[model samples]
Target: MALPPRQSCVDHEEISLGEIKIKTKDPACMCEVEVAPQHCSVDIKSVVIPIYLKFVDVRCSIRFKTSTLCRGSSNIVGKEILHGVSGAVGPGQILAMMGPSGSGKTTLLSLLAGRSQTNLHSGSITYNDMGYTKALKRRMGFVTQDDVLFMHLTVKETLRYAALLRLPKKLSRQEKIQRADSIILELGLDKCKDTIIGGPFERGVSGGERKRVCIGQEILIDPSIIFLDEPTSGLDSTTALRILQLLHGLAQAGRTVITTIHQPSSRLYHMFDNLLLLSNGHAIFFGRGQDALPYFSSIGLNASLLMNPADFLLDLANGNISDTSIPPELEIKLIQSKGDSKVGKPPELAVQEYLVECFSSEVAFRDSSVDSPPHAKDVILPPRREWSIGWWQQFLVLMSRGFKERRHEYLSWLRVFQVLVSAVVAGLVWLHSSADSEKHLQDQVGLIFFISIYWAYFPIFVAIYTFPQERAMIAKERASDMYRLSSYFMSRTLGDLPLNLVLPLVFLLITYFMAHLKLTVGAFLLTVLSLFLIVIAAEGLGLFIGAVMMDTKHATTLASILLLIFMLTGGFFTHGLASFVKWIKYVSYTFYAFRLLIKVQYSRSQVYDCLSATGCKSIASARVMADVDLNEAGPMEDVFALLLMVVGYRILAYVALKRMNTAR
Candidate 1:
């Protein structure tokens, strides 16, 4: 095997402007090649496929619907956010979008990254001068503003799963693992590779390492274009500088890197190849980073030599020119532009309008020395493969990940202790109740009702928090085209089933034997089966509620109201309900479960002692069940009803997740 030419062997042109040195790579030798260590030999392709991203006349506006009470109708009010912003970034360069908060930096980045835009937006965003296609989705990567990761997954585990799911299926599993190991080495994450990525409560990797892990996940596929939203946010100056250097290295490897930056230090500003300055959703300047200072000075806005260039640019965008030394002509130009916008606007608004006009009027800036981007018809895109893995493969991988991440939470000592303590207390309260007398029979009824309601209550609350807690993580993964939504949904559902059953099964075993509900094997199995069905049905309903609400507090509130209603109509609390509410029992799965338990324990031929106005007499169990309305449904009928609920609620939850994915 032959190694590619080294970086020193490639021809390069250097230009000096003031204190900044700009290095331009030769177009004929643009491909980037990497040499591996002695033990490992995989290398980046010698010929790179480049992506040129260009957007023209981009505009975005949001509509706010305001109600007019007097007219009994609503009016649509529109506010323009991004106004005709335009720029272009090509291979082997970093384009940095900089502005203060709410200046449309993140919004423009989202649009370019192909995220969902619910508002009215118009723009021509092209790659290689071509429109977006589904194939392009997997070819690009997006890192969100916030780090979305499994808190329990070690750094190596996170990257390994990403490699398994994102890498091409043609590669063997061992090869994919090796790729992950290489990324860990490249990112200098070897020290903390085994450490878990912790959250608010747990101690884990530092902030810089977490951000690097997020980047590693995206780059696992070697994306042609990568979009990052505030990747340097919440980090110290030194760490942020290192991150910028890493991005620069990626650009040098022939990847198109575009990122949103809020406020950068002086040292960080010079690292950018191109800069897009925005204010109030309007572009103030679009040109090379080094040329910005010269362009501003030419327009008679001069900054102090000691002042940070980033701060100076930010002040100009913010319409704060108190520290800036403006020439007489520029001051006059600001006054002349006052009447072009609103009549009685503030001085700051006037200055911003003047700057917007200044950039728009610069023809030389619009037609720089850069060559025109190639047309789509002239460029040949590589053949894109289908999803790296099949649906079942995705399900298995996701299931494995979910189990590894959630086992600790599911089998925690606190939860185990809680279940055990509750089981013991309930068993002692109704210990060894015989079915011979009416009082004992009533005690048995209470035990059966407790089994039905207690099991339902435990899982419903727990599962309601599932989707709400993982909404961000799910969205992030789905956006990356890592796997189908169905794969994730199924894996999430099945991964939890076994772990979720442990405590419940233990609770039932302890209570059933201690309370002496049934001695026969068939009866014991039936009781356990009934509780399992109840758990599945209840968990499905909880998932549905969480998916619909996607907020912890709201989902919990709705689940509480819904479960309370179901329990009330579960054939135990109320018998003489109004006709309108009588039909609720048919829909409440808990009602079916309770009926199944009653049928399992008490047979139709069983008799109980009763007393009414005379000596004690015998009463048939069938008559008692009839009075309570539990005898209407057969045991098999109850099982089918519960099974139907288990399927129906799960379907609803999945549909909800699909809608959310589509919305994004």
Candidate 2:
């Protein structure tokens, strides 16, 4: 007998006369595994991944920590949420986790991704392969339930940046592009790869395209297991079927594909060979789909032949064991019987003994029961050298997105234009006035305080307006481990620069010219410098408040309260009244700086240019109490205070952000 033709590195095997060769491809791990068991063959020309998932355990949670405020609502009590549960998944087989809407099905997905941990009291999510689940996030890929996109970047750029941030340099230029192309086509995003993904603010790709792009990013890394929250959700029936077919393709090619889906159509249900039914955070049925009837029958429910067994299983799944539909005793007996089979034997026991025996020879995937690597640490973080793409790349991408987001709007310089108009008007009106009107002196004090308080609202708006929308995206991405919190903070701090710089510069140029009391070249420069510090303080304050508050309403209310405090203790409005709250002024950035700027610009009779906002003579008669020259208002006194405000608030915001952002 002749031997089979072999093109691979390994030697050939003796062949039957009518043998058929089949091939399959993997774009992420970048390899192919062939089989000749049947007439059909899948000859994979290329793949991106050479590795596959050894094991995967994802746990999604909705933490209801109900202390006092949220305790009464049945919705949020100590629901134990997705009760103590476990499932095993590897390559090739589809573990279709089926359940009702509130059965914690989605929560299980989130938990497996390790996105939520607080509401979850005790559990261990271990990925035997790829090594790190927490610190080394590059190893896992998560496709969230929503369509999140930048709206500015096209599908190609979106995947490109994600790959740049994830793939190592060793993955050559050609390799990266090839992998990206593979993922692009793999998800059927070829047509819309150049299209922009849309958001409410900007228009681009459709929902299905957006979801594919999100998945494309994870595929770029060649993760061991790919997790989808609900890939078929909201999609049309045809599109939904296609999405599942894509997942089916991935599983067949030897990549672990785990997804949480609601009740699917008969066509969709038939696609799944394995089933995991969850009810009330518990797994009631887990085994082959065909075995469902036998499994239920063993528990005393003889489901009629030709009946849609899923319906009976689901109907019984309703926790209504007390109802006659499923007598309480029978329900308890059924549940107890099922629960008893959950352990001792490995999860693979659910499959027939013969299938287990044949798995070793028939299965093409890397084993899921792989043990921990000898050098592995519990904390899974990448080495420092892996930054061919990472925070630095994302920082640049976010900053670019921020710029584009602003550019399409009425220019960021619009505020500057408004200030310039105000400056021209103020220069024309107050061309001459630097005299002894005590009433004028009092008016200036009120104006300064009002500006201090009013500008306080700007940073809050910047933080809240920008952050709330991003809150949803951040949570979604963080759950997938796409980027870290530190990177977002750093990017945001840098990204916010244009607005901060532009807004304050305009306000200062206008206000200084309008209030021309006295001016020196040194005083002019120092005033601009002082204005910058105030803006920095405000930005930090806004981020801090935004990070702690979940809702914009609460953030706005808190911001208003803080603004009142900044104005009162700022030494501009209530210097005398501050006697009761004097200590507040010491900690208030506005107080020290407001006092400093006024003293510097209004202390003496100094000559001024008409172009200067605060004109030729210092109103000496207002208060001769302090002869401290306008040029020498003593900045050292508040310099430390300004630094403290900036440094203190930023550190606080970053810390708060760390606790809040669990998406990455």
What's the TM-score of each model vs. the native?
0.89, 0.71
Best by lDDT: 1
lDDT of 2 by residue, 1-664 (tens): 1233344322222222121121222221113434443322223223323223232223334445444555654445544666555556655656677776787776777666555556544555555444333533444577877766677777887776666556565566566677777788878888988887767866788776776787787767656567888788888777778778877886776666778877576677777766777766666666567876665565444544344555555654553222224224444444454577654432122221222222223332233333443322222233431344467766776676566555443244565576567556655545444534545555555555555554555665666555665787777666655556678778777776676766666766666666774556888788777777777787787878777785788888988887778666665433355356777767776676676666656555532243455644455434432322355546666677777878888888788767765533
lDDT of 2 at 457: 57
RMSD of each: 6.4, 9.9
Clashes of 1: 0
Clash pairs, model 1 backbone: none
Worst 10 residues of 2 by lDDT: 20-29
What candidate 2 gets wrong by more than 4 Å, as runs, is 1-79, 82-86, 116-136, 151-153, 171-182, 190-195, 290-313, 319-398, 405-450, 464-469, 475-484, 507-526, 607-636, 661-664
Write the residue-wise lDDT of candidate 1 on 1-664 in tens digits.
2233334422343322211122324333223334333221113322344678888888998889999889989989999999999898988899999987899999899889878555489978888767776667766888888999999999999999999998877678898999899999999999999999999999999999999999999888888789999999999999999889999998898889999998898889999999999999999988889988998888888875569899999999998888888878667756766655756666677678778888888732342234434332343443452576889989999999999999988888999999999999998998887776767777788899998999888998999999889888887887777888899999999889898778888998989999988799999988888888889999999999998998889999998888889899887766777899989888998888888888888765555663444545433343336534334445888889999999999999998988885423
Q: What's the lDDT for residue 363 in model 2?
A: 31
What does the lDDT read for residue 616 in candidate 1? 50
Deviation in angstroms for 612 in model 2? 24
Q: lDDT of each structure? A: 0.81, 0.59
Output the number of the TM-score-best candidate: 1
